[model samples]
Every structure is written in C-alpha cells, then in structure tokens.
Target: MELSILIVDDDKLLVDKLEETVQWEKIGISMVFTAYNIRQAQKLLEEFPIQFLLCDIDMPQGSGLELLEWIRDNQMEVECVFLSSYANFAYAQKALRLSAREYLLKPISNQDLEAVLSRIIEETREKRERRSAEEQNLGQQRKGKTEFWEDFFRNPSEQERMLAQVLEEGFYQETDVLILEVIKIFADDKDINYKKDLSLFNFVIRNITTEFFENNEQVMEAVAQVSDYEWVLVFRNLGEEERFLEASGDLKKHLNKILPQRSCMYIGETRPLKETAVGWKQIEIMEKKILPGTDGILCERDISEQDQMLSGNAAYRLPPWEIWQKTLHNSEDLDGVCRNICDFLKETFAKGVLTIENLERFLRELEQLVYCYLGEQQMSFSQLFDSREFDRRERDSFHSLDAAVGFVEWIFGTIKGRGNSRRSQEDVVSQVKDYIEGHLNEELSRGILAKMVYLSEDYVSKLFKNTTGMSLPGYIANRRMEKAKDYLEHSSLPVSRIAMEVGYSNFSYFSKTFRDFTGMTPNEYRNHMTKNSSDKK
Candidate 1:
C-alpha cells in the first residue's frame, strides 16, 4: 500500500526544509503535506488519507500533544512522531501515552529521520497485512460453516449423512457429548444502527469467542451465524457443566468489555451427536421465552425453573378488563391510578405469568379503556397525545416490565391532564432547562427527562425546540460546552475532570466533542484564554 505523511510545525522554514530534504518516497511515503499550525494540520488530516504524522511538540497556537490527542479521540489510525527542541520528560511521557512512534529532539540527522520513518512504515504495513489475512480466513471459515449448518438444519432426513460428514471433518465423534450456545448482541445506544454494521461486529464477536475457547479445555467444533445478530457455537466434550458455566461467566465479562454492544449467552443441553438437532431446537425455544432486557448468561435450568413457576401458578388470572376500566374512569387521583397499575404489573411479572403474549393482551385492553375515557371527555386521542408518541410507547412497552409500567404511567398522566388545566409550553420548557442546568454532571437522557415531566420524549423534544428555537440535543451540547469553557477559563481542573463535570464519561470522546465545538483542544483553549486574560490585566 502507498503511504502518506503530514509534517506540522510552527516554523515554516523547518517544515519546508523537511519536506524538501527528506527522500519521502524512498522511506515508503509517496505523498507529503506540511502544515504550520494545528488548524491547518487538522484540515489536511481530514482532507487526505494521511498515514503518518511528524509534528513539533511546541507550537504557538496548539502543541503537538494536543493535536495528537485530537487524532486519537477521532480514532484516526495514524502513526505519530514528536519533534521537540527541549528534552522535556513530561512532553515525552504524554507523547508516548498518545501512542507516538518516536520522540526525537531537535537537530536530528536526516539518516535518523529516515530510519525512524522506515521502521514505522514497515510496522504499519505488516500490521495491516496481518489483519487482512485474518479477516479473509475468518470469512472463508464462516461461509463454509454457515452453509453446512443451513443444509444440516434444512434436510432433517439426511441427518445421518451430515453426521458422517461431521465425523469426517473431525468436529465431533458419535460418543462425544456436544453443547450448543446461542449468543445474541443487543445495542444499547439508539443512535447506533447495529444492523448496518452487523457484518463487522459479527466478525469481531466470532474472533473473540474463538480466542476465548482456545484457552479452555473444551474444543469448539464449529461456529455458525444463525441470524443477523445471533451466532451458534458447537462444543464437543464439554466436561463438568459447572466448569463450563464458570468459563461462560468470564467470557461474558470479557465480551462486555471488548464489544461495543451487550451480549447474552444461552447454553443448551449437552447431547450426543445424533441428538444435536434436538438440543438446538430446545435451546432456540428457550431463548425465545427469555424476558426482554434480560442479559448475561442463561442456561436450560433457568428456563426450566421459569416453566415450573408458570405451571405452579396455572390458576392465576389477571384482573378483568371491566374492573380495570372502572377503576380508571372513577379515579380522581392520577398518581393513585399509576401506582395501582405498576403494582399489579410488578406482581404479575413476579408470578411468572406476565408472558409477552399476556403483556400484549393487557396493552390492548388498556388502549381500549383509554379511548373510552377520552370519548367521554369529548376529546380525541390524537388531540390529547401525539400518535407518534403513543406508537413509540407501545413499541417500547414490549421490551421490558419497566418500559410497560412507564407507558402505563404516561398514558394515565396524559388522560389526567385532559381533565385539568395543562401547564403552558413555556413553563414546561423552563422546568426542563432548570433541571438540566442543575444536573449537568449527571446523565440527561431524553427518556429520564420525559419521565420527570410525565411527557413522551418526542413531545418533550418538540416542546423544547418550539420554545427555545433549538433541538433538545443541540441545547444540551451548547450548555455543556458553555460550562466546559467556564471551567477551562477560570479553574485549574484537568480537562478530564471538566469533561466529567459536563456529563461525559469517556475523556477521548469529550475531547473530540469539545474540539468540534470550539475549534481547539481543551489545553489550547485554556492557553489562549489565559493569554488573553493576562493581556487585558
């Protein structure tokens, strides 16, 4: 692959000299760009696919360390080398922390520069080639295994033939007991389009799983992608179920740390090769019955326990729809009604009778009750609540018991407002703003804010926008940036601390966001502001 490099320095002469003197092409750098400031360097990096960065540690506008921080924050894959006039240990330490390839003092010889550049280029090329080969091998293995399992599952009559094929492949023996595990990945962030990146995530997850089992005593026979977000792993001779469970717990923790998404593992029964299909079918059924929001490792025993609990309470029945409707119609206290609904749902869920089908039926009944109440008040549902909000609530209600209870509370809260005087839009927006200002250090999700005001997230966002002439996220970001600036200008707190004070957990992400907002890194901004303050004084 052809490589490119960018040289950044405040001294234009130094940058020009390097560009003219270095035999970049001989050092595997086919293209070279020179920038005299951090801003210009940032622009060049964004515009060109630069592979290497050689920057001076001290600059007038922004230091090379700050620029490197920005690059790392943006996840740019660039090998960096730092040039410094003074041999400052602190500067070298920070540079190394940011993954700089080398920290060389000023007046370095051309031979040394070429040697460093040549080494970085060779290392980068080898790393890329190794990754490419691994991905290719993983792709081939996945394709073959997926095809085999698809056919094996499809042609039940040819099971004996498939068994023979598996034996020939040495994946399993007739006497070996095999275990099947189904892993499902769930995206916690609503903004992440997981489906669009499932292929890449699948490859990563597969690699992690393979590496995990390689260290264990059990042999992983095969891995197959069963669906868009699901994979099935076949393990042979998985001795001692307790040991397997212990290892699975560790694996789940590792996956949670490394993967960008959450995963749940469902362990199937260990059966002989001839009964592998039956084991897969049983595990699939058990996985479907798992309650929403349930994660981590689940096994057949959990499902079996749930089934027993349900069978033990076979006579349990929910309250009649008429009774619930009557209670809703007569209740003058909205909070009381909400509390009653939540209590009932919680009790039912605890009893193991709140299946997905049961939850759907309950929601349908609640909807009818709501419509009847709205009609009696001479108000339409859409007039009282946005249709989009209602749809979102309904869709989210199926995800978890907490979501279902929240939906119910929102529904009743809206109904109560129809009978009473409603708060003005300005008042609601002001209330939300005050809360946000007071809680800048805490998580401020739309859902949490919506719950605080008994409004839907969509409704709250629209209301905030209508009142402030800015989107909800835009307002939050502005407030955060303003606060961050105040801290940087007046206080001596570290940038990472300021980031936490403004509700950001990841320091790198905070740096990126701050740069995008202010056009300078935190340190640069602090320096510039301090200099201006000194001049004014």
Candidate 2:
C-alpha cells in the first residue's frame, strides 16, 4: 500500500526535474528517492523499502544492470524500469534478462514516464492484494463477513505488511476467480430459515467445489464465503479454462438438484496471478448481472455482450405497477391477466434502462404488491401457492427482460387458479335468492345468506337489494306468505299448523303478517285460490 520509488541517474538536473514534475505519491508510491551515482543508489536501496526502481543504465562507477544484479542477488521485492540515452540492443537485452518492468530510452518524454509509472503503480497495488489474498490462505485470518473487504478496499496502505509477505510465498500464480451466488426462494418462511439454509448450502457448495478441483490434478483452489449469499473461489487455471467452466456448470447442476430452481451461480473472468484484484472487481460487477430466466453459471461474456442486452424489451416502457395490481386484483379471467403482464414486460424490457440492480428492485417491489393485493382478496399466497417456490422465482428467476416478464405472468397465472375457489357477490346473489325461497319454512336472515355465499352480512344485504330491487327481509317475508297461501289451498292442515310450517310461531301474528303482506287473510286468499282452481278445471 505504501510503496516507495528510487530514481537513480547520473544527471542531477534531470533527476530533480523528474521528481518535481511527476507526482509519484498519487500512484501509491509514498516516497520518491533520487541518487546521482550508483553508490548513492545502492545506499538508498539498502536503507529503504523501495518496491519500484527507476535507474539509469549508464551510471558512473557501475552500470544500472550491475545495480539490478545486486537487487536480484539480495532477492529484494523491487520492480525495475531501465533508463538510457540510447536504444542499444545489448542494454535492452540485459534489462529484459533482469526482468525490468519497462525500458525507457532517454530524453524520455513526460508521456512515456507517466505511462510507465501508471503501469508500475497498478502492478504494485495488485501485488499487494495478491499477497493479502495469499495471507488469507496462510492462517492469517480471511476477512470475516467482509469486514476486511471494506478495509482493504478503502485503504491499501493499512494492510501492506501481511500482503507483501503473502506475495512472497507465491501462492496463486495464474487463476480464475469464480463468485457463486446461491439463489434460493422459501415461501412463507422467515429470514431465520433462509439464513439457516444458506449456511448449510454454502458449506456443501464449497465442499463440492473443493472436491471437484482436487479430483483434477490440473487445478488448485482457495474458497471464501465472502457474504451470506456469495462464495468467492479463486482457482489456478493451469491451462484448463474450459475444464474450469465445465466444473462450474456441473456444480450449478448439482446445486439445482438440491435447492431446485432457487439456486444460481455466477462466474467471473479468468485472470493472471498478478491481476487478482481485476477478477474480483469483475465478479463484483458481473454478479449484479443475472441473465433473465437463467439459474446457473452466468459468465461475464454472456452478459457483457450487446446481443444479450438487446434480447428482451429493450425498447418500450412498462405501464405503472399500480395498473398491474388493479388488473390482477379484480380481473376474473386468469388468461387475460397473464396476457396483460406479458405485454407490459415486453414494454418494460424495451423502454426502460435495464440494469441488474434496477430490474431486480422492480421485480421485488412488484412481488410485494402482488402479495398485498392478494391479501385484499382474503387469499393467502402461502396457502394458494408455495411462497417458497415463488420466492425463488422472485429473486433468482430474473436474467433478462423476457424472463422477468414470464416470471410475473407465471405468478399471476397461479393466482388465477386459486381465485377460482372464490366468487363475486353478483355471481352468487341468485343462489342466495334460491336458498331463501326453498327455506321459507325456516328462519332466513342476511347472516345465514352471507355464510352461504362466503360474504359479509352487510354485503349480502346490499347485493340482494341491488339485484332484486327489494330488501332481504321483505323478500323472505313475501316468499313465506306466498308459500302459506299455496299450502292453505292445496292441503287440509289447520291455519295454526300452517303457521308453524311457514316459520311463524304464533298463529295470530302469522295471520296478521300474512294479511299485511298479501292484503288479505290467509283463509280468504286460500278460498279465492280454490275458487280460481275450480273455475280453471
């Protein structure tokens, strides 16, 4: 993190100019030391912990190559850049042989110096991170819960010592870093349940990956559980890039079998041992990019390509979420709801700027809205459909705009099936009327009718009034009186017994109520009905 650079040139004025004009400190090189001769350069090298060496090839006393030889002999951790007035082949050959980072012919332009310094700084910084990663493997404690991750990213200088030592061990020389995000959906389950499952699942996947690499002698790996849902695996490719990919794909298959469609894996780009941080950064970026309707082994190349980005509704805007909610909330035809969702998803994919973050956020909020809407219908999503299954679809199911839209449609389709078990007030009001007429001998109240149709008492009253243009009690009483007249004319039963059958306990009250309903006494109406019947015969 705190790197120092040494500029050794026989030209004093050139050394001073190079030191003053170029800001070495900006590139993680905290200290810049200059020397006029090889003796002075060697003394500075011995005295300081310099990681980068910028030395003149043609120094007085001894050549820059000789000074480099001493550095190699001492096994010092220094990257070198050779400077000379001429592009001599012999000097260039010697510099290459000594593993110099860059060879700049003198009267070097500012652009050349800046380019060389920028490269060296990046190389040096990566060297530190690789060392830190190796130290993580050396029982020096890998970052717990990404605590060290934040610190390492925030300030590299704070972790220089162990990182430098880690690189010295030369652990991972050339490797590919794979970040596997185990995606799962648990319906009607708590966060505690998810946490428990994730822990067990992460362990199994880690074990599987380790065993996979161990079985192949061509590969070696270091696995870290960087977050609750993510695992970071750095493996030496050993010239088997395809093999690594195959193993990742196979691992995805295995995980899918165990966790169903809830599990997914993401793999980053393969990189050299020196650029470990680049692969890490790539993983961080690519993890946010899951292909729609995909569950496993999403490669960086798969999402980075424009073809993938343009695959789904990349041109149109979605109607507001509230519109979808209202449609699903009230629509009876399940097929219609699904079709509308499909059309909207197309538009959403095409019109909106889609990124993994915004897209996933949109899907999550939509799921919540669906849940709330279902609740208004008095339907429990957990009871009607597996929340666990849908939960996976909610999170792991998004990979493209088309896929996202399909997932939403599928969810609505399931809701329609459950909705079939429940009906509206308008549809069931006739059934309530039929029941009231058939049960005139018994007490028929709005509460009873509501229970028959699974609606509230107040709602049943309103529905009956709205449909029949009469109050529920008025309908019931009128039906009872009409039934009483039919019985009086058709049977020889006494008025009191007839009253009992028609749900009237008192004979006098029944007589009075019947008179009020039909504008005549029951006996009078019966006599009239008999006279009409005889005349028709």
Candidate 3:
C-alpha cells in the first residue's frame, strides 16, 4: 500500500514542515516530491512514478488548479486534492469540475491532512488490486495468438520478428488481407453513464452484423477507442475484393433494418493490408465531415477529395451532429423533422451532390437518432415501423412536400379565416389539464393555466367542462385524490405531508375530502391496507 506523493506548492517553509511532521514511512508512504509549477511537477512525474498529488490553488508561476486541469485533459490517472488559501467558491467549483478528491483551506490542519492522506492511501491500494487482476487477464492474453499479436504491435523483439518471418513464408502469400475500419464516435464523454450508450452501440452492431454478413469471417481485427466521441474498429477479414463488394448491399440493407434510428457511420472501402493506412485515412477524413448527432452508414465513395476541400474552414459546413441533435430538441414533431430531413436528402440527391455511400451513412445516422427518440418516448421502433399496421399520425407526417406545403398553407389560410381559430380551445384545455396534473404542487389557477397554454381563462374553462364533463378544479381534486390513495398505501410519507403534496394546503380539508371520496381518511386508508396485508401474511 506504499504510495509516492507529490506536493506542488511555492511555500518552501510549509513544504519543509509537511515533509518533517508527516510520519511518511509508518503510513506506507515511501517518497515525497515537491514542485512549484506545472512544468516542474511534470518533470518530477517523469522521474518518479507518483500516485497522489497535493496541489496549492494559488502559486507564483502557475496555480495547482491549472496543473490538475492539464492532468485531467491529458487523461492522467494521479489522484489530486486541492489546497488553497483564497476562500473562493468559484475556484472550488472549478476544482470539483476536475474531480479533485478534497478541497482544503489555507493553513492546513494536521488531523485533516492526515485523514485525507489515509483515504488516498486506501484508494491507491484498491487501484493496485484492480491492476493486479487486470495483469492476470493480460497474462492469459499472452498465451495463444493474442501474445504474438500483442508482440507484433507493442514491440519488435527477435521472437516477434521470427513469427513475422514465418507468417510471411506461409499463409501471408496465399491470404488476401482486407482491413475493415469501424469508427465509433463518442467513446469518451461517457462518464458514469457510458455503459448505457456502449450497450446500445454493441447491441445495434451485433444485430446489423448478424443480419447482413452472417458467415463471412473477419480476421486480424483491431478495435480501439479513438476518443470519447468516437471508436475505430479495424476488421482484417479473410476475403477477396469481389466477395467484399458483393456483400456490401446486404450489409447496407441489414444496417437499415437493424438500426432504423439516427446514427451515422462512414465505411471505408476494402483494401489490401499493404494499403491499410490509405483505407484508414479515408475513414479519418469522414470523421472530420461527421456532423454531431448524425447517424448514417456511409461508404468511402460518397466522399470526394473536393468535398474535403470545400468543407474546410466553412462557417456553414452543416455539422451533421448539431443539426441532428437540434432536430430532436427543437422539433415537437419528430416524425416531421425526420421526413423533412429525408426530403432534403432526396432533393440533394437530385442535385447529384450526394454519393450512394454518403446517403447510406446519413440514413444510418438518422436511424440511431430515431432509435434514441423512440427510447425517450417509451415506444419501440419495431412496433412503430412494422409493415402490418402503422400509426396514422406518424404516417401522415411523411407525406410528399407538395402535400405538406399544401396542408401548411391550408392551416395558415384557416387561421386567417376565423380570426385565427386554428389555435383549438380543446387542445389548450387538454394541455392545461395534463400540465396541472404533472405540476400538482404548484398553485394552478385557471388564469395561470390559460396563460401557460396561451389561451384566455374563460375559453380554457368552458373547453375544460365541454371535454371532461366537470369543472377544472373538480378534475384536479379527483386526480389528486387518486394519486393520494396510491401514495398513502405504498409510501411512508406523513398523512399531513401527503395532503400538501397532493395540493391540499389544509390537512383537515384533505382528510375530509379523502373520507368523502373513499369513505376513509388518509390515515384510515393506510391502516386498512396495513391490516389487510397482516391478514394475508
């Protein structure tokens, strides 16, 4: 559990005091290093394998906060605790952003300092245990072909050279190696929630691969996380050029079938292993063109050397990602937005601007986005896209532009026709009712609800009664009562608090209303459920 500690502070006196006072050896801390600036600390890092860093927020040359930020940006693993004399909340907030373990005030306390160091020591021990476990896994990898592969990539010892020579003499001459580069975006930025996104990517890719190239085996593959936003998958498959091209259509179609939502992909052309770097560069170029929030399966043929040139330094390169994200965030009618995008694609194709590969890639990106939308809406894409039955509302949104433009015109004309009665009072009434039920704790008067839905109070009130056969207040109370009954039975919240939660300010009135509704007060309801449960037991 011994740890190497680095202290980065400008104060020589404090550094000497800390080094002398702290019982380093007894606590399993062997080495203590000091630096006044980030550059010096970095040099020290190279010289000594430091485990934890105690950094001062303010320094003469550079602050400790700056050093921590640099470390985080570079994906450095050393744990850091911030020490600052200035009582600045902003600095502390920034430190927290960098995931600093602890923030300490100036003139550090002996007890506080010791406690923090002890915690870091334990953490370092845990990290060592985890690394030890991984080392065992890596050791297993050193057996079989993986060892040879690792040696080929990591180092060039005599054994690695001998293996290469053997391969060159045997299967290397007969085998036609083609590299399949699968680039994944957003590999970093996952934070604690990366598993969800990673699982989705894995699930979609598995389905696509199975549906398309079922038996076609890939060889000598390499998959790496390129960045937080991307993944690069190099599939070295055992196949000739013709076989690869022949499977392309099925591959594209299967991707369409499997990933029917928004996700973009740029597939590079299959090339011989000698041209691996050339093929990989094509995928890399596509990455620069990939717009945020876009999902499509694209081929290398879809991109031109000219497109790359034009895409250079343009303010309006149309970040596929930004537009794709906006398409979901800005539009209430997601289907309409998607259809608009499709129509845009169709029009762009007519202009001969898009290659078949680019179009397919764009479609894949669209499919992933749509999948995300479906997930958010608690709907299944299969259920929505199934051929047997279709949702009329969503289907209607996909009409030709002529049809959509005409309808929009018709709606606009109709708005002009009865002094803009297109804003349906019924729509306002339904929206208000749903909104009130959602925000039950708020003071929801007819005036507030009307203003929210952009309608007159009188109009909203009349429409409310017309639709539900009750006044707005009565509807709210009934809904609140229903929710209260469920919470009362299941939750341990006090009856009085439950009353307030359900929008009843007066606990006595809530009890009376509860009794009136169910012939039992909130407390009585809870007791009845409890007694019934005991009887069942």
Q: Scored by CA lDDT, what does every candidate get?
A: 0.79, 0.67, 0.61
Query: lDDT rank, highest first?
Result: 1, 2, 3
TM-score of 3: 0.34
**TM-score of each predicted structure versus truth:** 0.49, 0.41, 0.34
Q: Which candidate number would show the highest TM-score if scored against the true structure? A: 1
Whole-model lDDT, model 1: 0.79
Tens-place lDDT per residue, model 2, 33-73, is 99988888889889888888888888768899999989999
Tens digit per residue, CA lDDT, model 1, 387-412: 65577567656545666787898888
Off by over 4 Å in 1: 1-147, 150-161, 168-171, 187-192, 195-204, 214-216, 250-263, 289-298, 301-316, 320-353, 366-422, 429-454, 461-537
Of the candidates numbered 1 and 2, which has the greater lDDT value?
Answer: 1
Q: Model 1 — which ten-residue stretch has the worst lDDT?
A: 308-317
- Listed per candidate, the RMSD to the true structure in angstroms reads 15.7, 30.4, 23.6
**Which pairs, if any, clash in model 1?**
none
In candidate 2, residue 126 scores what lDDT?
83
